[model samples]
Target chain A: MTFTHQSGTAPASTEASVPYLRLRAVTKQYPTGGGVAGVDLTVAKGDMLVLLGPSGCGKTTLLRTLAGLLQPDSGAIELDGQDLVSVPTFRRNISMVFQTWALFPTMTVRDNVAFGLKMRHVGKQDRNERVARALELVGLTEFADRLPRQLSGGQQQRVAVARAIVVEPRLILMDEPLSSLDHRIRVQLRAQLKDLQRGLGLTGVYVTHDHTEALALGDRIAVMDAGRIVELGRPVDVFARPTRRYTAEFLGLANVVDVSADGGGYRTAAGARIPDDVIAGRSDVVAVALRPDCVRLSQTDDGGTPGVVRVVEYQPGGVLHDVELTGGARLQALTPVGLSYSIDTPVFVTPEWSKAVPLAD
Target chain B: MGRERVRYPAFAICFTLLLLVPLVVVVATAVNPGAYIKFPPDGFTLDWFTTAVETPRFQSSLLLSLRIAVIASVVGLALTIPTAVAITRGRRRLRPWVSTATVLPLITPDMLLALGLLIMLVQIGMASSLIGLVLGHVLIGMPLAVQVLVAALSGVDENVEQAAQTLGASRATAFVRVTLPAILPAIGSAAVFLFIFSFDNVSISLFLSAPGQTTLPITMFQYLEYNSDPTVSAMSTILIVLSLVVAVVLSRLGGLSHLAGSPTRRSS
Candidate 1:
């Protein structure tokens, strides 16, 4: 299966020479070394940037820094060409939707959405209209009078979103806003959020570990590991052709195989010769990241390499076979469910090597 | 019916009667026509109530006690809330020491605490004055109030306040608009405990207040030392009614339920 980018997508609005949001070597370090390291990034106007990472990967610290909830130890943050690091959190025209929703328990849904406008000293008439519009956007218009405790988890999170956007903040920061909901609700809300983000042309910086969420929502994805963005690209590019093994394996079901420059193509120790067009003249390419879908297992002896299937795990649409070559190297191959293979079955592995992503040493 | 099924309700009724029996006897004696405090009245009359109200000493002491209770409770609450917030948000090390000190007052003998206050205030020449009485009452009420407030402040979600700040509320505004309302029930619970504590206190008043200006409890203790009339019972009935009013207010504010609940919001 191939991952494809959505076609016919608009560029939204990009006006200034500088990116709408720019971070210059932002750093916030804890003594425990778990905080965000020096990081630099940029997101254009009306674009969604997703920071994807595992726990303790500093994605949250970075988001909080942007929201002004956290002060970076050292960095320059600019939004709309204005300095943000010097602004207090309250004075900053940025909003965040927390993972826990964080709705004021005492306030009703309407009041919760209105809270931001009220704090900004909006008039009562304008506040009511904006709150109604925000609540309607989240499909929570009828539940406006209900207290947060009375709402479902999904509903409360939507209220949080409404509250964040009601302020029409210069930048919106969301830290795994859907992580706390049920899987079904997460999927549903994720779709609604994507629609809202695109329809409103919102500029957002979302932090999530779920790759699907990042792909569906972010115009650009930043894959972080160990407090650093190891790879930054669009979701399609980052997933289909990662420049590094860290991001390729972390983001997709890609196998990193060690290889060396051989006669016509790179050859793995397993005696598998992968023919990537990009490696034709490269002498320094040492490995290729192989997506399971890119490699195929067949019953022929000379398809590409000879291997014995060691494990067979069945999935809905595909069957995953782990094959060990004569050189003792193991590689994963995903085939159609109909092309089933039992354990210990000798199979010829044929990889579409040209589609394989060549990784730098 | 099984005894196990009846055990709790039986004990409940017994406990309730044990409480009401005293209230009934006091009310009955306050209306008794006899010259001494007695229950199961011979002939009903409210002359004792009139006599209790007419007595200048009773009037002054009761009024004085009310004034002290309100002032001491309000002042104690103001000090207690900030102190609790400080201890709750400060270093975790500070919490254990403060929590231990608050627990100390509950275990120490009342007379010992009163004695300590007397000596300290007398040295400053504040003993036998209203200020001394208020200080003594505040010292006792503070622990109860602070314990509740500290628990409430810490139990609140810190992120809720941060969310407010992100929505454009300043730190002070966030606390006032978000955290304070979240813990309002706890505040009401603490206030009730402090007010009743100061209102009914006799040991502190006995040791601190001047003879003529003693609180109602202390004044009654002295009155019964010589008088055999039912005036003391009459005053006691009124005090009980006043306490009932405060208890009603506490219930309206959800104070009783709040005090019983663990100081934490039910996480979704």
Candidate 2:
């Protein structure tokens, strides 16, 4: 049987063209002074928006407020144009997958998945059917009668996912749900979660500090710091063209250089002049951020800025040459792993002009 | 390792003997063929046990004690579960004061508490009634109930409750379905503890019981004051055996360590 709404209202359509979830000027201040401050975000139906940040950045606060676990000091939360800030959490029709699986230890896997349906007083037949379907979706059908402690970490997390989605909530909030798992399981579950969200066309907000996760799973990434979204855009766009210094440094491995305007060009603090074409049309560019992968290294000191390699570290994919420029600016360049470069070796570094991002002071 | 292996057995034997000797003497006296409560019984017989069970006063007092213990412990649990939940889930600033207040009765001298309750009950005109006795027992039993329930509730992760609320369960439903089941073992252990405490109490029962409503412990005390019979020894032996049975049953159900906030043991 198709999943039906127990409340007699039509299930929210994944095809609805409007933003399914919106938070406007949401502010919740802790007494000790750092909480979410004026966070404004919108999640369109069927889209996944990742809130990416470090610890203490209030991403979790924003997620909790969206989940109605926290009441914002001042803000309006609307889902499908209904005011959600005033709604009690149980009536919000939003589900969350926590960092810790939070599966009820006393309940079996099937019962855990059926909890939301039981809360809504669905018939036992339908509840069992839906629970079976959800467990099948998460590939935990054989473990239905087993308690949470009987499952491995990944399986427990899968149970958590099944529990969240079995409710068919209008919006799903995940607070670093994959953060606790080991690396391989995290990667596997990340792919599964992304596919599941898209296949069901469920709009979701995912929070994480891991850059690879943000880039891999988010349709759009909102880079946050100090309780504010510093950058918001498509993942590739945000990664390639971060407008803020914080975003450029936080979202990618970047070499940030302090530069000054030099007659229609840019000059580093160490007095190396960067060509006009590399400055990217920003006359006010006080600095340029280059990704380590974008800088090319050559031994002949031709057609680029000359620098001495202070450290040559070997990585699996490539070698990293920590280069100190002639005038004392330092940068890293990625080269082939087998190319031998000892410490104190001289090399010339050239920035790929298209990859240089101009930043405001 | 060698020293520890030898020392641990020695300590175990000494400790076991320390606890077993008094109980052994009581049992020996209860089985003594001669009358006069002598240890290292003159010979074995079940006459004192039969005598302790057959006496009308002993029978009535034992039944009264059981009734009071069951009723008072059930009421104590009812009063303390909600209070414990509130104190644990309430404001951070209020927790310490509330906790200290809940446990105040446990630290107070039993004589002082009983005297205070007697005066209060008399002024309220409930003195010497069974209701007054149960109320007094509840006051004394509440601390144990609160301590056990509070530890159990604290062991529960708050996120699971929040998760339930987000899953469309009202606050009350979440508590009953999730929070309550998570701590049920602790609650059972607490009720048993309160029952035993109320059953064994003498001071509060001494002050609260009226004529014909004497509890078993108070009756035993009064009997020992004037009599040299082994019946009191027989009663003590029965009480000890009852406590041991309760302990064994509780362990079989689920151990009491979970009430002390160890992680809940899952039966896989």
Candidate 3:
């Protein structure tokens, strides 16, 4: 699939309504360094906005600012037209699911779920029914009598989710809630979590360092780097077409090479001649991102870029090949399972030109 | 069968004998027929036991020690809760200094602390008073309580408290409801330790005792100064029995292991 598109921008919300959550020019500086700076974002009602970045990128700081856990040095945060900056964390009526699960070890699952209602002085009868409803929502009613420690890690996170939603909070903030679970369970829970959100029409902002989680779960992905949103768009748009070099590399488009326009073609760093068709009609294309899946391999000289397969790794549905071009540039290609090529096998690499996304940096 | 297995039982027997010897001697001397404390067959009599129990000075001093221990442990525990929370959760990185300063009173000689406290108390006109004794005991008991609490508090995730607060709990309510219950076992253990620490304390009490307001340990030490009688031995036996009960209860509360720096038994 060739991804040919112009520079990307955040699409208008599908509902065409006012944003439910807004952060404007939020900056928090630390004397010892590594804090968020000048962050601006918006999430329409019922949207699941994901903040994805590496460690120390201040995704957490931004989330904390929204939750009123950390006061930003400058800027405003508004949720549902009310200024969250002036709101105390406890009064914000926002629930956060931490990576630690944060279940009360002393309390039984039912009491843990009912904690939010109890804090609000809800009558016992009302609190109990809501608590039971929440347990059934997460399918943990059978384990309601068990303490948090007695439950498995995945069960505990479900309890945390139940506890978070039972309050019917204004906005839910999840800080890598599923990151602590094992891979098999994480995927399963992520689908259910999204379903729960949509079923309730809940507005949420989730932070995670895992890019796959961002691409898989986000209604709209905000790619953050160095405490700044480098790019913001829907998952399909961002993954298929990234405008910056960082976004392409971070999103697994790893075959990025420096290029210079020469006549009607562009000359790659390793001296390979790529025709103007891959340039996407850009007069100032300095680099290109060739996704591994976009490249194809063959045993014959198919007039494609010639390279030797240095490594071939068999994956479930396909084989991943790392090929070193004759011009000394290396590119990775994924082929179907039966396409097996051992090491040092000379192969033709055909990167689909239309799918080769150009980078401005 | 194996040398390693054989060595373990041998060490266990030796350890048991070491603990039992003093207890057996104390029990024997408490029943000594002679005026002086003695082991072997001096003939058995319960006269000294009655004398130790019936004596007014002993009775009053025991009551005084009980009162001081309860007061000091309660106040010291209340004081250290904030200190522990500050060191464990404070945004600043002064934890090293704060932690070291908290335990300083534990390592500094109790006698020196008593002496310093006495001089300061005299300046404030509180010398040789019950307040002086309690002040000294709190200084002694606070370090252990703070250590237990800091370990317990740090084991609790900040997110747990945040989870509560975000659910509409005020800051104080979150701590009292979520955090306090999570570390309740450690708090129980810390309280038990502080109580026991102040109960048998003599070094600080001896220096700080008001006239005629001495504690049980001070009274025992004073009685032994001139008399070689076995009444003190009888009192020692009674105390040994009480201590045995306290030790069992302490173990049940997990105080003994907690004193050895056990962080938490709960899984993360």
TM-score of each: 0.87, 0.92, 0.93
Residue-level lDDT tens digits of model 3 in B43-123: 989999999999898999999888988998788878888888999888557998999998999999988998999999999
What tier of docking accuracy does candidate 2 attain? medium
Query: Which window of 10 residues has the lowest lDDT sum in candidate 2 chain A?
Result: A1-10
Could you tell which candidate, 2 or 3, scores higher by lDDT? 2
Off by over 4 Å in 1: A1-17, A257-288, A298-316, A321-331, A341-355, A359-361, B1-33, B38-47, B256-267
What order do candidates take by TM-score, descending?
3, 2, 1
Worst 10 residues of 2 chain B by lDDT: B1-10
Sorted on DockQ, best first, the list reads: 3, 1, 2
Q: Using DockQ as the measure, which candidate wins?
A: 3
| DockQ of structure 2 | 0.57
| Model 2 C-alpha lDDT per residue in residues A1-361, reported as the tens digit of each score | 2433232233243343577788899999899877889989887877889999999999999999999999999989999889999999999989999998688878999989999999989999989989998898899999999988789889999999999999999889999999989999999999999878877777799999999999888888998899888888888888887777788777657888778877767777766677677776776676778888788888985788888999988877688889998778789888887675789988888877566778764
Q: In candidate 1, how many Å is residue A83 off?
A: 1.1
Q: Candidate 3's error at B175, in angstroms?
A: 1.0
For model 1 chain B, give the 10-residue run with minimal summed lDDT. B1-10
CAPRI class assigned to model 1: medium
Clashes by residue pair, model 1: none
